[model samples]
Target: MQQTYQTLNALTNFYGAMTAAESARRGYIFLGSSQDLQRYYNAKADMRSQLQILQKQIHPDESQEKRLVSLNLLVNQRLSLLEQSIELYQKDKTALLIQNNITVSSVQIREKILKVIADIKAEEQTYLQDSLEQSKQSIYFRVFIEIFTTFLILIIILGLCMILENQWIKRERIRDLESSLAQEKKIGDLKIQLFSMISHEFRTPLSIILLSAQLLKESLENLVDRQQLKNIFRIQSSAKIMNHILTDILILTRAEAGQLDFKLQVINLENFCLNLVEDLQLFATTANMLRFQKIGSIFKANIDERLLYSILSNLLLNAIKYSNNETEIYLILKSEADMITFQVIDQGIGIPLAEQHKIYEPFYRCQNVENIAGTGLGLAVVKKCIELHQGEIIVESKVGTGTTFTIMIPQENT
Candidate 1:
């Protein structure tokens, strides 16, 4: 009876250690902390040693020994599987660092790990229940033999009750944690939906304001004095800037919702780019500062005009905005065998190398550009547009030197 109690105590301690290790593993996986991982490994090794010692010390009947061996093997198998998953997670994290690629596969793998953890917890509960049942049977048999020992029986009962209560509290904590995680996920999803709806709803009013500004500019052109004309120009520019912001928001909303429609039509590449530059030049403070150059023989290609316009206009506007009036902005177009590459170069306050990676994220702006007027969604919108056209955009920049945006898109053969 004493040996049985000793074995049960060791098993309980081993289970506690396993639970601690699992928690540490979860922390390492989600929070990416090496310290937690180290703790987990330490606990795992301790658990293995403790279980080995207990297995050798507790030599019960044939049936009970078989049960103990089976339980030990089950735990070892689960721990080994968990170790593999942790190793895989480490590899995935390393790959993410090296490649700078955020793929859905990582999320899927995390879900798999979470599921495995859940399974392990369930198995632990089952094992604990089986052990408890066995212990109860042994205790009841001992109580039947020693019916006169009422105080000892009461103490044993109280201990069993305390252990069951501890198990209940632990299970409740796990349930609460799962609930909180689910709730957070739901909130995140709702935020995206809300952002999309708000952005979509804003376009109508922005379009009206832009139209009114254009009409006011046309009506005052001949009647107003030079100063008034300048005021009107400022109003028009402000309205245009607001309109661009709204367009970016709308495009981002559409992109997020996977609703961006592409209407492909043949367009004259050189003339298309020239007209775009001409349109943007109105917003420029200096005359002849924005230049367009075509490197190769440009031909008509099937392209979505609106998306292409959005891409070029945003890049050109950014170049103009970030640079001084005296600084020249270059828009270079190169037509390849099956692709068209566009480059927008500007002698602007360039982005830092560390910040360049985050520029494409929605509403992310460079620290230097905070004082400058921008919605910070221009590059994000440009990236989305390029992605829709199966294109790639790369940036080259040095602080106080200059910045260049290179975009390459496949020419649709139609």
Candidate 2:
């Protein structure tokens, strides 16, 4: 009974210390005072020490062990929440210092930290109430055992032991579930890292192959027959296509890993779209059938050049690949006051309405276009790039008619 009382007191003290630390952190955020921030850190350290002591002293009998475990789990959860809150607060503070402004994102982070702290305080209060009730129950059980006959006491103790065992089993199952979730998250992170590494490694060799193909085409231009010239061009085109695919894979992997960097530059919309269309014509089966139209006045916009190129190139390649050889593929650029829109319209096999949503998923290929050779990553890359630019992509398609992908990106200023 004495040890149980001591354990409960330790838990209470720990909770109090944690609450103080949270208060200090909140003060630091609002007051922006170094003294308050230092006090917050010191209080957190003291809370950590108190937690360690509480964990060491929490030794309960078999009948009370399940309650102890539940208390410990709650305390650990509170500690975890505190740590997360601290990290987010630090990040928000650093952002404020660097930018010299309090952005909406920073304010949101502060609100999230406050919510986490509130949850911790609420859990602590609930645990304290439960502990008080358990203490009262223990007192009653002890008094009853003292007055009861030996046989009756034994039966009562056995019943209590069974109840504790069941509770322990339930707690173990909950712990196992938590462990499984953590392991799954770790596996997902590892998969993304592996993808990023492999995609990066492929770039060096792909670049070499593309360069070799280009050199071979140049070296054999004079000596090669018409058939040989065609083969050389094919080799170059294939290598270029392979390189582009690898680039898309790398970009997607980076984006997934949150490492994609965007460098914005001013570019003329009309010339940019026209040049990309003309350059892609070299790879088009019906080169003469490719067309470009300017639907609005030419204007300059700030955009990431490389990402924009990938978006346009991928869409154009899909337009050419899915359409008939003789059909026209159109690249239309339209600039408005507040937004710029690029439309890739192809007069070929259109996407099915049912599968349109899945088209942007990584490595997803349309069932009707399965016969066509493709990595099925083009549209996925296009969609990701558009999202990075804070843009929207609208698909208009009919099963037999054609598909039109319209991308509208908001300008920096209206």
Candidate 3:
């Protein structure tokens, strides 16, 4: 009974702390007082304390333990959202804007938290009711029931034997399934490890080959034969394409393992876009086929250049690959106070409207692209990179017309 009381108290205290933190956050945002900031910090501490207490109190209840995992996540998200609101307000005096944006999210998270708490309380109450009812039963009544149950059990022995035999067969099948699943997991792990190793092994040589091809092409600058020069350039282009493939493979493997590395660097947006376009255009072996443009005031940004490069390069290469040699592909860049947007537009073989959803899937090609030479990993790689940036991608396309990919990623003002 005392433990039950403690568990309920902890649950209520956790809720109270969250509410206090939210109130303090709003108070600080509106009033900008140090006292409110201090209150917020205190409330944060109390919430953690309550969470720990609840963890201990409900440790024995398996169902409650699972509920606690979700509860923990909700509380963390709420706290982070509240804390971020305060931080953003401090940085930009964005009280009204931030509050308005988070109002719906805040309400939804709180409602979910309340629902989970009520469920936990209901479970505990039912359990307590059952305990109380059992306590009220007389000992003689229980003995009578037990003796009656034993007689019934004797009469149902043959039925029990049959049920046990069926249960044994089910257990055997379950064991086989478990074994098969274990084997599959082992094979999958090996495949990932082997792929990582092979990508690393081949990427190094492919990079060296590209470098050598570049150097060889330069060294043979004095050669008058156009055919040799063209062959050398082909070697360089093929090596570049191969290097890009291995890179995508490595990235996909790392992303699957949840270890994609992200590091931000200051980059000139205009120069980056221009350089990327120029490089990919050379690889496309086309004359002035790609167009680049920029919008908005900001030109410099702190961003993960590697991931950004992957996202843009894949989209650009795909644009070049899918579009006709005579058609123009556009790379549009826009920067704002709070976010950056990229638009990759291609006026070539457009994706079928019905097949757009499957494009982001790795190695998935459109039915119309059957005659095209591609591994279909480009858009999938782009999708992974966009996710790592915590961004969103939208696609608009029509069969036999064209396609446009718009990506928006959030970042603070430079």
Local accuracy of candidate 3 as per-residue lDDT tens digits, 144-181? 45435534643574375467557655655656777766
What's the lDDT for candidate 3?
A: 0.78
RMSD of each candidate relative to the true structure:
31.8, 28.8, 26.9
lDDT of 1 by residue, 124-241 (tens): 3444444454554554454334333433544664586577557655655666777766755554454455545544544444445454454444444445676777855675576567
TM-scores, all models, native as reference: 0.51, 0.53, 0.54
Write the residue-wise lDDT of candidate 2 on 220-253 in tens digits. 4444676677865775577578668768877887
Colliding pairs, model 1: none
Query: Candidate 3 at residue 255, lDDT?
Result: 73
Best by TM-score: 3
Candidate lDDT (C-alpha), each: 0.71, 0.69, 0.78
Clashes of 1: 0
Candidate 2, position 314, lDDT: 95
> Which sections of candidate 3 miss by over 4 Å?
1-192, 225-228
